[model samples]
Target: MLILGCMVLIAGCGCLGLWFAYRIRRRPQELRECSMALALLDTEIVWGATPLPEAFGILKERTDVPWQGFFGELKERLSQGESAGIAWKETMIAQNSHFCLKSEDWNVIGDVGKGLGRSDRTEQHKQIELVQRQLMVIKEQAETWSGKQAKMWSYLGFLGGIAGVLILI
Candidate 1:
């Protein structure tokens, strides 16, 4: 019974590690998806010269949750007559919990809104491109760090649990 209990504890610890690792693994994909959404926004801006709300509406359809939610919120805000920049910031703050992004990532995203209605087409394109690049950088960072640490986290959890069981024994 003691041995069985130890094994169960160890398994639980290992599962915790795996869960952490799995969350880490998903971060890169989330950033990549954000990058894609930005790209879609850029396309709408450059080719269609689409208005901010309509561009975000298009993105809301092309993206997944959290992203779709973010864009949808922006569209809703715009429809309500909020300024584009203000809507962007408000939606970002409101939907922040839904993303895996860090504070730095949020700052980068905030920068994307700085030139919304104030900028020329060329400048808007540049801002979108810049944000897209930043997102790609974050995605690369997540992929690199996860590649190194995810297995380590899993192994450490398994080993730490085993050690704990041994100490108890």
Candidate 2:
């Protein structure tokens, strides 16, 4: 009876381990897709063109990732330009979406922010403050994503260990 109990436990653990492994295998693809999306956003910003609204819409539709108001303001600024009658700074503060940083657009915003203080005063510098704010948001979101992934991996490891112990018994 004791041996049977041990066998059962071992099977349970093995099942858990397999579940974790599957999750782990799937995560990289998600991350890769996310990274590629962000790269596309970066390309658009580098060219000084407005990002596709569809991209933002898709990101918003797909992920629960967090973002800041500043990104929206940046987008609006690019879309409306100086004549749009909206205060870029204020709009940045008002715009908030978890969807923003999940896409590649955040990185492009960061690059644009770095050039703000320079004498060249390119379009990149026009929204420097907004970009800086967004970069911070992106950094935070990346950390959060990493932490979650790590936790998932750790859980998988624990389950695997339990399975091994059960087998030994």
Best by lDDT: 1
In model 2, where is the ten-residue run with the lowest total lDDT? 83-92
Go through the candidates in order and give each one's C-alpha lDDT: 0.87, 0.46
User: Which candidate tops TM-score?
Assistant: 1
27-116: candidate 1 lDDT, tens digit per residue: 788788888888888889888899988998999999997799999999999999998889889988999988876788789889888888
Q: What is the lDDT of candidate 2?
A: 0.46
Residues 1-169, candidate 2: write the lDDT tens digits. 8777666666776666555555544444444444443444444444545433433444344433333233344445545543222333343334424232233643443344344223342454345435545555555565566557656755665666566676676
TM-score of every model versus the real structure: 0.88, 0.34
Q: How does residue 149 of candidate 2 score in lDDT?
A: 64
Model 1, residue 24: distance off in Å is 1.4
